[model samples]
Target chain A: MWQLFTQNWQDFLTGFWHTILSSIIALVFSFILGSGFAILETNPNKFWRGVAKVYVEIFRNIPLLVVTMFFYLVLPKVLPAMNGFTAGTIGLTLYTSAFIAETVRSGLQSVGTGQMEGCLANGLSYWQAMKNVILPQALKITIPPLGNQFINLIKNSSVLAFVAGMDLMYQGDVIASNTFQTIPTYIIVGIFYLILTLPLSYYMQYLEKKLA
Target chain B: MAIIDFKHVDKFYGGFHVLKDINFRVNGGEVVVIVGPSGSGKSTLIRTINGLERINDGSLIVDGKDMTDKSTNFNELRRDVGMVFQHFNLYANKTVLENIMLAPRIVLHRPEEENHKEAMRLLEEVNLVEKANSYPHQLSGGQQQRIAIARSLAMKPKVILFDEPTSALDPEMIQDVLDVMKLVAQEGITMVVVTHEMGFAREVGTRVVFLADGEILEDSDPKSFFDHPQTKRARQFLSKVISH
Candidate 1:
């Protein structure tokens, strides 16, 4: 294990950094997209609700590898050519957003219907009622589920490995192949993932407690 | 002029009729109390005034604007008519003060300083000035309902609807909410209250409306309605309610 570290520290560091960057970027974008779609799903208008439903169903049903591969192998043929990292991040964002949307929609529903009626009766427009009264309560209910979706998103960023996106898992595969030390190399990669995820899990628990 | 007028109104919940051929009018400064047994459609009748429940047939007018017209913006009409729910639906995320300040600031576009001042005044009216910064859950049921009342008052509405406001309160807490409501009534704000509290109906209401099976059986001054109820149902309901 020490030998693997000494031999390929630079590669491991670069992979770790890339993984962190991609996850952060995907996390932010997916949150925005997921929240938007969740709001759309909860909207009274049939058209917007249908659009959100279709988006969530399509992305959530497909496998993560398949989604990543489409962007990596299929998208470039239709649009401008994109690199592996960008493709993987986009795929990760879209895939995770579906789960997030579902979690958030449940949260919105958990808030009593009276909350919306109260705001409307107080002269708020529908959107205004949603933004001011409904969403705040919904967010509180969604935080625990949202945290799980985010943690899953970070782990799922490993899909980049299949496309040679140079993330931590990709580097682990490369190192294992070249050094023939598969078990140790993978162990190191697992440790790095724990390093990223454990704090997030603990933080989410803390947040849930504080909010409760 | 009447602040709210319902002419031959009918409302149906699918196959079940909720309100039937209701002809009701709330004149300015009149406190109208509606009393009925459970499932008698008292709530449905009051909710229609602010467009919370849409009437299936007939014309409904609020503040002189025809609520049945599709072009009439319900949000604008709601600005002049506020409602307090039986559940005391204060915003769970907001402080008591923010609950009062939100609609006025966002919907009315009241200047912040003016809005804040009015919110404080309203809070004082409800006797919750000390709890302005507290969240809804932190307050007791009576306090929460009072804050809800203050929130409705912040809009300075022409009419306020109270839908069984005291029904959810503790027996001990009921008086606090009723006191605030009584003050609101005395100030001449047109009020439509649906309640089981016979004392409030007789003392605070200018007129009492007796409803049964989706129709108004009696609409008369509180004295006549209580002392000389015309209908058998009204007499029976009054005896049962007043005895408790």
Candidate 2:
């Protein structure tokens, strides 16, 4: 493991940086998309609600790799061509967003009906009440679950490896094959994953305590 | 003119009739108290004034607009009406000052300086000025209710509805809330309150409406409603309530 890393240190660092960049992009986009869909799912308008439901159901039921392949292979044929990194990030964003939507919708429901009623009775328009009063409380309830989704998103970014997106896992596979040190290369990869996930997990626990 | 008027209002929850053929009017500056046993539609009735509860059949006029009309915007109408819930439905995420300042700033679009000044005044009115930065969960029940009152008052509503405002408080805490309510009543703001506190009703109510089986069984001055209680149900209700 030490020899592999020292010899291919540049390749490993490049892969790690790529993984970090892709994960950050996916995380931001997925949160915004997920929250938008969650609002639509809980909206009073039937059409918007149905649209959100279909998006969540379709993406959530499909495997992440299958979705990535569709974007990588199918999208280029119908539209403009795209690289593996872009395709994988889009796939990861959509897949993780579906689960996040459901988590956020449940959080929205957990807020008491009285909160919305109190806001409306105080003369807030529906959107105003939702943005100012309901969403804050709902987001508070969603933090723990949202943290889980983010951690899963980071792990799921590994799916980029199958598509040749040059992420940490792809680098691990390349280094293992080139160096023939399979166990240590994989162990190093796992340590990197833990480095990403453990801090998030602890932060989420701390946030839950602070909010409580 | 009546600030709130309900004419032949009917409300149903699925197959169950919640408010039946209700007809009443609340004029400007009058404090109307509604008293009834559990499930007698008192809360439902007051909620209709602000469009919180939609009436299945009837016309509800609030501040000269017909709430039952589809064209009437309830949000615009609600700007003139405020409600304080039994649970003190203060925005749990907001500080006491923020709770009072939110609607005025957002809905009414009041200037920030004026909004702050008025919010502080309302807080002072409710005697919770010291708890300005405190969250709802940090306060006692009576104190929370007082903050709720200040929040409602922040809107400068023409009418305020209190739905069992003091019922959720401890016996020792009830008087503090009632005292705040009494001061509000003395300010001559139009109020419709649903409560079991007959003492507050007799002391502050100009009119009392007794509800039972979803019907307005008695509507008279508090003195007559309490002392005379013409209907047998009214007599029984007053007897049971007063004996306790």
Candidate 3:
């Protein structure tokens, strides 16, 4: 493993950076999409509520690999062909968003009804009450569960490897097959994944403590 | 001139009737105290005034706007009406000063300096000047309730609703909240308070409305209602709550 690390360090670094980029992009887009859908799920309008329900169920029930494959294989037929990284990241964003939506929606519901009523009776529009008063309070309750989603998102980004996305896992597979050092190559890949995830998990704990 | 007029109003929660054939008028500067037993719909009745609880039947006019009309903007109407809840629902995320200033600034678009001055003045008025930067969870129940009242007053609402404001307080803290309410009453903001404090009803209320089983049982001057409760139900209610 030591000899392999020294020989292929540049290749390993490229894959590690790609994995981090994919996770960050997916993490950001999923958060926005998830929060928006969660708000829609709670909307008073029936049409919007139905749309949110359908979208969440579709992505949440399907496997992440299948979702990513569909984007990689099928999406290119209709839209312009996207490389493995783009397809995997887009798929990861939509899939992770479903779980995040549920987390945020439950958080929103947990906030006492009186918060909305107080703002309403105090003379604010419904959206104003939601934006200024209710959402901020819900965000505190959402931090822990939302943190879990983010950690899961980084791990799931490894699906990019199956589609030849040149992420950490893909590099591990290539090096193991070529050098026939499967054990050491995969071990290095696992360590790189830990590098991405452990910091996030600890940062979430810090945020939870500070908010509390 | 009537500030709130409920004409033949009927509200039902599916099969259960909440407000039944309610016809009443709250005139300008009149503090109407609604006293009732649990599940008798005093909260439901007061909620209808601000369109928080919609009526299933009849025209409910508040400040000349008929709530029954589909186009009547409740949000716009709420700018002139305010409410204090039993739980004292101060925005948990904001400081005490932000709790009082937010609605006036966002909804009314009050200038920033004027909004800050008004919020601080209202905090001083509520005797919570020292708690301006503290969050809602930091305050005692009575103190939170006083801040809620101040938050309502900051809107300069023409009418205010009190839905059991003192009921949630510690016995020792109830007097402080009642004192703040009495001060509000003195300012002649039309108020409809649902409370069991007979002493407050007698001293601060211009009229007493007795309700039972979602119907108005008695409406009279505080003296007549307390001294000579016309209905047997009102007499029984007064006996149960007013021990002193």
Best by DockQ: 3
Compose the digit string of candidate 1's lDDT tens values, residues B130-160. 9999999999999999999999988988899
Candidate 2 lDDT tens digits, B7-63: 999999999999999999999999999999899999999998998888999888999
What is the per-residue lDDT of model 3 for residues B112-221, given as tens digits with 9 covering 90 to 100?
99999999998888899999999999999999999999999999999999999999989999999999999998998999999988899999999999999999999999
Mind giving the per-residue lDDT tens digits that candidate 1 earns over A104-147?
Answer: 89999999998999999999999999898898889898998899
Ranking by lDDT: 3, 1, 2
State how far residue A33 of model 3 sits from its true place (Å): 0.8
The TM-score, computed over Cα atoms with residue i paired to residue i, of candidate 1 is 0.97
Tell me what fraction of the real C-alpha contacts between chains A and B each candidate also makes: 0.82, 0.80, 0.84
- Return the TM-score for candidate 3, rounded to 2 decimals: 0.97
Q: Is candidate 1 or candidate 2 better by DockQ?
A: 1
- Which residue pairs show collisions in model 1? none
Q: What TM-score does chain A reach in every model? A: 0.97, 0.97, 0.96
Query: What residue runs in model 1 are displaced by over 4 Å at the alpha carbon?
Result: none
Question: Comparing chain B with the reference, what is the TM-score for each candidate?
Answer: 0.98, 0.98, 0.99
In model 3, which runs have C-alpha deviations exceeding 4 angstroms? Answer: none
A43-74, model 2: which lDDT tens digit per residue?
Answer: 98999999999999999999999999999999
2 versus 3: better TM-score goes to: 3
